[model samples]
Target: MQLTNRSKQVSNKEMTLAEKMYLPAIVGGLAITISHFFRKKPTIQYPEVKKYLGPIYRGHHILKRDEQGRERCTACGLCAVACPAEAISMVAAERKKGEENLYREEKYAAVYEINMLRCIFCGLCEEACPKQAVYLRHDLMVPVFQERDEVIYGKDRLVENMNDRYIRVANSEVQATPTEPSLTRAAT
Candidate 1:
């Protein structure tokens, strides 16, 4: 195709009076803006106030206890096996004959460590515990620090007794007699 070299007749255009003044555009914009000023602000100020966490929200790990208040973890290694991140480590020891009251099972974890840096907090380890020895709670209340090494949680940091409400609730639940068809009940 032959190019049309003749400079195409330039089309000249001018803004209409309303467009040129720019007043209508600004007024139209302000009409919508005014509605926002009177409406209640939905924005929640963070840090000043935190939102409510759900009952089962998995935030941080805690070692659980049985009704007798003994450590629930038997160190079965299932938690370590279930950990996709390999965050859990344990040294299991045999419970001597006289130590049955101290340990729930024949084996107990002499040393337990969970590298929080490596842990994704997926709650998989909690699910893997047959004795229900672990859970995540809202009391992930502590602020994290800059040091990575400090994040590794040992057994000492993991165990916690119930707080006021939890203790009352736990005790109430404890006092309630267990019904038949034992598998039907949900623990907590």
Candidate 2:
């Protein structure tokens, strides 16, 4: 029973004396190796020079704050739910009468923690954020830690700093910092 019209074309051709010796094959491989030595070096000098990750790369998690310096996260648990690795965890707390300036909404995240060990950096938490509060910084990466406690990031480390804010602009071209001229500048 033929499965189809397909059949193997077996070559029973005899090899020449040169093909049997494999001297040409060795010479061809040597030529390739020699050519690579003359070519430009592919490795970059680490520490002194860092590779630029694309704008959409998901790195360390950050809970952003609004222009008014109020916490933007409403403690809605959306980011936690969106995290496929179950890395995000937060405890919602009601904002007090006098603490309105501290938080943007009535309900706020009192305790937010992201387990770095469990997180896959999938960027789902950033997408699920309705208030645009949670984001993964493309420039900043999560550093290696010896202790297990250091891997779990809390609100203290995740909150945005007023002096240094991570601004994600359009096109994923450039991330203009506080010192940069503009955020939406064309790739130069």
Highest lDDT against the true fold, candidate: 2
Query: Residue-pair clashes per candidate, as listed?
Result: 0, 0
Q: Judged by TM-score, which candidate is best? A: 2
Candidate 1, clashing residue pairs?
none
Candidate 1 on 106-158: residue-level lDDT in tens?
Answer: 88888999888788878898789888787865434334669977887888888
Model 1 weakest 10-residue run by lDDT: 176-185
lDDT of the candidates, in the order given: 0.70, 0.82
TM-score of each: 0.69, 0.77
lDDT of 2 by residue, 13-71 (tens): 99888989999989999999999989998675544445555676678788899998999
In model 1, the runs with Cα more than 4 Å from the true position are: 1-22, 139-142, 162-188
Per-candidate RMSD vs. true structure? Answer: 12.7, 6.2
